[model samples]
Target: MNYDECHTVKTICGPHASCHNTAGGFFCLCHTGFAQLSGKTNFTGYGAGCQDVDECLQQPCGPHGVCINAEGTFLCSHMTPPMTSHLQTTLSPFVHCLSNLLKDQSIIDNCFTKRLQQPPADQFCSLINSTLAFARRMCEQKGEYRQKSASVTLKDVTSFGNKFVADGSGVESATVFLGAMENFATLAALASPTQELKAISSAHLDLDVRVIDVTNRRFLAHERLTLRAKNDTLDIYMKTVTEEQQTGASVVVFLSYTDLRSLQRGEFVTEGQPQSHLLTSSVVSVVIGNRRHRQLRDGVNITLSHTSQTQGSLSDWRIFCVYWNHSPSSSHWSPEGCEVIQSNGTHTTCGCQHLSSFALLIATSKVTPPANRLQHHGILPNPAPIQNVLQLRYRMV
Candidate 1:
């Protein structure tokens, strides 16, 4: 049949589409930037069979821009560049202030390298920036005063300082300078794990911390430190305290163990048996204030050290600070404020809070009763009573 005589059908292609008819079949073709509604290259139906092509799927705008799809076309919107110039101007003073506060060369180098080269994550950047800003403000506020006696709590400074150190790549020298300026109390408090000590033993211990100025040979600050230690192990605690005025200040800690059991029993052990326990280091000068020029703060860094006369023995030997408590009925030693530091083991470095009169108590290792005694009593002898008491006492130097 001829084309005209075959069939005269109504236009079936939708808008933006062209319809082509051959002998007996007709097909719809969508125009550029348009597609068939059914997602086909071509269609044969009526209605609005053509739809705008989603150019967004191709991401024509690139990485730093947004693509907005429109009728038969799409728009590319580029993002604004970051305001680094303004940020750099604002952060310069704070960066300088932080650098001045940090004395360690390595820490200073690391801090600047990472801060300038690598962009920190948003959260950490905000934290460090805010902290440094606060420190700068503090320095400014205190600058106007003539005496410069303005006091800031160590707790407040330490909270931010610790966060800065931790997020600033764990700079040890920076931490030390911050600790020294804040009066070493935070370091001392952190050195002794109080909660862990409470769970270990019931023995009562008193700690004291002192700051000595080595340059001028004088005592700066002396205070009692709340120290906690495992009751089972011989623990020593030390911290260095420094003030703004003091540069070469050293912290001296004196530890003294209190024998609560002996105090309760109205018995005081004064002299310790020589072979009962071991003494490794020679008894140094017991007077804390004697060697004013000798700096021992750095020397005494170990917070806890454990030594047994015989290895793997369950019984723990204790060193006590013994001084007259002046109670008429009580003969026990009080380890409150004596000035003697003593250790029973050799090559052992002890850290204590303050100087105090001290004594040693060597505990008996054997706790369980003999098998014959257990058989006769039809039960094991009560070990708790024997274990709680100190067996021998050694004189303090």
Candidate 2:
């Protein structure tokens, strides 16, 4: 058939298409990069209805890739590296360290194996690994593993020389310092008698901890920490401790111990001297003998009371308290209003007059000069006592 004759015959096709005469009739063809909207590629209709093909809908790109649709074709390109999300930035440093460590197969296997010994192995392993990683990071960050470099300058030597009237004055000062250290060491050795008593006592103790925002004078969080004299090591369960109220606030923690008598020998609380540290920009941990203090923000106090069930009796327990402030200029610890309120062989109650970061030290007998006394007797007190109408008493259950 001639083209004109085929055209005269009412050939059917859709828009955006062309009609061409074939042997007997005409057929419709769509434009490039497009398809027949009605699902017909070649048609004997007057017009061939065509639409753009959505190549992106077919997902022609690989993982981490993007597809760009154009005319009748699509282009696939790799996506750019993803920006660090807020969640990643907010993740604790310990989590990052543990994630890196757990990537090792041997560590994972050994950890999992150890965890299997305890029921709920997976959960315990996770907690243990995370805590270890956090502690590791803290130690490294605090330079515990790094030797500090002391840079002595000529100016320092000159200053030292000028501070003294005679050439032997510097030597004299060094001698005095060494003598004072020896005296302190002797005092500490004399105080070692408590260890003998602690060795005799087999009491288990429970710590009731409360965090208070001293600036605002409000309670933030309360938690119970349990310790057994036999374990030698204790786990501080702090997963539920919330930190909602800790932003830019001075915090104080109160640790109340059950069976103060068993602890009186200073077995559980004598690991280190009172020290304060800023764990992070928003978190702080303070160690005072047997008690630990941390800052949290949420305003919820969880009070736990329980009686001692250990074999040993608490007849000889005495309470000793000390505290530290994080102020750079003055962080030394001193005793506050801790005094014996009531006492029995099984239990003892103590009262504190003020709120600061304090720990409860258990000893068999009271030590002279008080636990708050500085190594050097000349150091002045940093915290003054705060008076309150309400008396706070820590009763051992």
The candidate that achieves the highest TM-score relative to the unseen native structure:
1
**Each prediction's TM-score against the native?**
0.25, 0.20
**lDDT per residue as tens, model 2, 23-119:** 7666777655457767777866544366666555666665544443333333333423322434334332222222222222233233533343444
Model 1, 1-397: lDDT tens digits are 5363113644467565667776667677775557875689987776456766766678766664444333344333343332244344654333333343332223323444355667545543343454444444433433431111124332344344434433432222222333223322222222221211121121233223343433344432432222222222122222223323232223433332322222223233344321232221111111132122223342221222333343233234444333323322333434343222323232222333332223332333334421211111111111111111221111111
Kindly give the stretch of ten consecutive residues in candidate 1 with the minimal lDDT sum: 377-386
Error of 2 at 99 (Å): 15
Question: Candidate 1: where is the Cα deviation over 4 Å?
Answer: 1-97, 105-151, 158-348, 351-397
Question: What lDDT, from 0 to 1, does candidate 1 have?
Answer: 0.34
Q: What is the lDDT for 157 in model 1?
A: 40
Superposed on all Cα atoms, the candidates' RMSDs to the truth, in angstroms, are 29.6, 28.5
Measured by TM-score, how close is model 1 to the native structure?
0.25
Residue-pair clashes per candidate, as listed? Answer: 20, 20
